[model samples]
Target: MFNSFLKLTSICFALLLLPISIMAQELPSSSLYVVTSCYVNEGSSFLDAVEEARATIPNDDNAANMMFFRQPIAGTNFEKNQFFRVVSWNNLQHWAQPRSLPATQEYSCDNHNRTFHTTRVVGTNGNTAYTDTDVAFVSARQCMAKDGVSLSEVYDWVDTRISRGQASRQNDNTMVQMSHKILGASPNVASGRMITIRRIGDSRQGYARFFDEQFMGTRDRTLGALPDAPFEFCTDANLTESYIVHSPGRGI
Candidate 1:
């Protein structure tokens, strides 16, 4: 009887590990994006400074592995000096390394202390359109959900919205390409949060198109939808935007 109990305990342990392994497999290594907030010192072209330092920055394998940039357009909540630097990588192993970029005298930065949730490729115009785009309009929304709503459920709802939006648009080039992922660690401001990024041809128009297609439409259909209301489940939704800083010949 004791031997049988030991075998049962082993099986439970293996079962517990199975989901973790499966989740790791689901996370795309090639789809990593790291965003850091920056505040430039008074009277300086922050983008140009970072651009100049790019060449001289020393070997920080993790930082060097990905592209860097500043996000310019944002909501009123974010200050004018605020910007975001984004990076992409292949595989979780590379992401695990300590990423370092120089904090020059030109600017100060605030980094997110979290790992990325699974990345979903909403749709692509061509295989290379995502990388080829000049700028990306990233919408970062931080919020928490009502009681009993699981994180996986939230992801499922988001995935559905992305799929429907992608399908609605016949021309991928005309509209923005959208994708979203949750933050693995809880953000300081909220119980849960998500970053939604769209690689688009124009920031202003693309931003408008996203709202008309995704947010407004989702709001209208929530009650009638099969999976039920996703947006209504959350409170304190704060959205802010950023413009991508292009790093040529370096992204995946």
Candidate 2:
């Protein structure tokens, strides 16, 4: 009888471990975006603007943006150097979706009172026909298309931060918001401070919705906002961290 009891215990442990292994297969990853402040000087030439952007970009990655130029009459008086920038992040779903980052408005420095129009980019024909999405697409393709840095370079940087390894109940409450901005934002997430998630050998699938830099960690249904909020944050995963989220608000 004792021998039979031992065998039964072993069977139970295996059964429990099996589901965890299957869930582990569903880890995640995602894409995101960031808006940064860059300065353009008055009377600076177009080449000067490009050089300024090059200096500001952190790395040699060709994906780094240099900004865009625009003018009103398609004339070359003082319009060629006027432009702004947009950057991208792969697997940071909320940011990469294209609409999250707003485009820069035209401001003037050449005309003393800084008079600027709702200026648009001029082709050889001087037409303001470009949409915000058009500009975004140009920057996106520019970085990934040519001799630029690969997604792996960015991944390598993020992976180093994934050094923390602890296990906890999968909190639908936390992490969703962090995916948009940065990781381990605890003060905004759980208990209000960013911290790396612990290691987990098993995985579980669930929805993630809502993101605010201030929201972090696991929140309770009775204590905080809706746990199963009505949206999806973003989605993608890896052995170290599951960056993707499929909350049911937007991507139905």
Tens-digit lDDT string for candidate 1 (1-252): 999999999999999999777654333223665656677778777666565456545544454344555455545566777665556655466767775555577666665553453444444332333344454444444334444555555555555665666666533342322234446454443544444434443344454565566555534544433436444333332333333333345432
lDDT of 2 by residue, 78-141 (tens): 2344442323344344233433222323222332222111111111111111211221111100
Scanning candidate 1 in windows of ten residues, the lowest lDDT window is 170-179
Pairs of residues at least 3 apart in sequence or in different chains that clash in candidate 1: 29-91, 71-243, 72-243
Evaluated at residue 204, the lDDT of candidate 1 is 44
Candidate 1 structure lDDT: 0.51
Candidate 1: stretches off by over 4 Å: 1-32, 57-65, 91-100, 111-118, 123-133, 143-152, 174-227, 231-252
Q: What is the C-alpha lDDT of each candidate?
A: 0.51, 0.27
TM-score between model 1 and native: 0.57
* Whole-model lDDT, model 2: 0.27
- The TM-score leader among the candidates is 1
